[model samples]
Target: MTGPRSARSGFSLVELIVILALSTIVMGGLTSVLVRQQRFYRGTADLIETRSQIRQAAGIIPSDLRGVSTAGGDIIAISDTSMLFRATIGQALACAPVPLANRIDIPPLTLANKNTLASFSMTPGLGDTVFVYHDGATEAAGDDVWVPYGITGAPTMSSVSCGDLIGSADLTTPRYSFPLASPLRADVTPGTPLRFVRRTRYTLFTASDGAWYLGYCSPDCAGSTPQPIAGPFLSGAGGTAGVAFTFRKADGAITAIPDSVAEVSIVVRGRTRGIVDMGGYKNTQVGDSLRFSVAIRNRK
Candidate 1:
């Protein structure tokens, strides 16, 4: 009655408690939404990267397998987590075809000689692979074949000093010649139909990092470190496994002959890695797998 009663200035205890509780609930919801979005982004990014790796492999693996140089256990050395095979390396032509010998003859066509230091791709090194094919129109009936040769040393080509041939003189071409692992079983003569020889290898190997990769090397894959053609085998529950190369005959039967492999089935498996454990996110994560069969054009 006399003076105004003291006005309430702050919230009551009960009111304060309710306000704090509501704020807590709101923040929790927002946090959950953010976390969910982040997780989704991570999973998507991982999947995309993995797919890119797979596509890169698709472009190379099949073609190399198809071009495998047939030989006795030389085309396909081992077909497990690791695979090894010979492939054509370059486009050096034989000016004159001669009988099977350990040496290859190169003409003075301004070719990029692998036997020269500037662009040496023909000089066979240890573990290098050499192959011969009859480009002749009338090859021996049974002579329709590809033979494999092992590389023994720094092969000598004609009288060239180095293995490079970028800007050499016309006369400097030197009629390149390089030795082979052994003498050829047949004759190779240059003409309307030229016999061809090549050097390269396709191999699948597991790196020190516990990942699988596809590698390619010149001459032979034996002594040289493989240049990865495909990489980072991400598979299994833990996301670390190698790709498998399955060779099949034209009739879908498994065979060992390099030329007999009519189809190659490749399978790649992988899973995304997690930054943090979200109730065992790996188990809940979707695994990735790529499988396809490639027909070998060079294989019968």
Candidate 2:
């Protein structure tokens, strides 16, 4: 007779242990990769958002602060933590007619119903210290503290009283090299590079017309303030105002405002959501750091 036999279907202890160990190793590797990728995606999202914010914030001044000024002097004050400055406003839309060149019949720059300085603390620049008819030379090395324009390198003319505007000469050569007490044929040095050319000066007659518009200037374009500059870029066509600057420090023992704050440095905070591993835990660090400068377009 055969001896009694017993059967067992379950795995051996060693086999089960090996299988568990293998699964653990695979899981660890996948977790590591997921963590790293999640961080990367979050960082990318934050960066894109920051870049967009920088662009929008930076554009506010350069594009609009062409001629911003105030009667109490050029006004400059920061608006908020993310944004900056909220200076008083003043500017007009006037009809300036040039004599000739491109768009021979563009019409005059129409004045706006009211004067809005359109001044804000969006940009920071040494240019704030500089004025349309400033009395000094430019610093070719450091900043634009007194970047002289005059009829030389930049605009010198005031209003487009006439229909004529300036023309494009060689960038390599500048026509007038100094400020003038007044405008006339004598302001420029005769040659191919006309310091001043005759062109059309268009304006936004009713915010509907698309040539150019007038800006406002207080008690005259002086002090530390900005004059609104609407459209149709022109030479010597600048407005002015006074500038007052302040700073905010994060240090527990906050020190006095730094002089270097010719511009305001801002870290714009924004949010974005996306599918990512470790969703909250892994990407928390990714959504926070972006910095851009909101300089005072007019920093003296």
Candidate 3:
């Protein structure tokens, strides 16, 4: 029909097929890379979340243990998953004029004789239990024993003056106003400082959801149903041996007596979240553990 048909300006079937094959290869590589990146991001996120949870669990344990009472028989019990002990709610430095009776007179022990009327730490609330400790009498050398006495009452600010104990007013020393649960077994000597603390029984239990939680009660562990302190935890996951405790005496000997325990070593172990059972690829669960020791100051 025509002298010589001009070569077609469009690609031939062979060229089109080749171009399609190359595009398929490039797209396959891109898809593979995208999938790999997605997996990496997911793994990283899981690790970070798990570590955060571990840190939260670890931080709370020490803070609670630090407040343990130093009085004899303060620690009620200790086990793999449970612990009961007394904790201090408030403390003061010194008691100058002594032989305290039903009331405690708190003076300004601060520098420059500053009146710490509102700064007293032992303002007990209702349903609160307090323990008084006399720090003056020396039972023996280096045997600073704190004589504990229990109290149960709401505290009030007292301004009336009685005997040598002076109440802080517009021109007097401040004092803690509360009724003692009972009179001291013996007199609190002069220059002997006093300490007040609240005792609580803390129990860590495994909930129905397979998570660990902290529960607490007042006076004694068997008095009431334990209420959770914060939220669920993953610290108790390792079957029967997940959580453990070891006690030591002040003389550095292992002791079973709860009162003689000066140091407690706690160990917690568990696997991170998002654990999978894929063979080889996810053969084992990523687990972490936290171990630390708490020195019971009062017991020691």
Worst 10 residues of 1 by lDDT: 189-198
- Candidate 2: which stretches are off by over 4 Å? 1-11, 69-300
> Which candidate order results from sorting by lDDT in descending order?
3, 1, 2
lDDT of 3 by residue, 37-104 (tens): 77666666665565565566567666767767545565777766667765556665333333546655
Identify the candidate with maximal lDDT. 3
Per-residue alpha-carbon lDDT of model 2 for 33-150, expressed as tens digits?
A: 9978777777666555544543443354443333322221233323222112223221111122232311111112221333221222322121222122212235453422211112
TM-score of each: 0.60, 0.29, 0.66
Model 3, residue pairs in steric clash? 70-298
| Each model's lDDT | 0.57, 0.31, 0.58
TM-score quality measure for candidate 2: 0.29
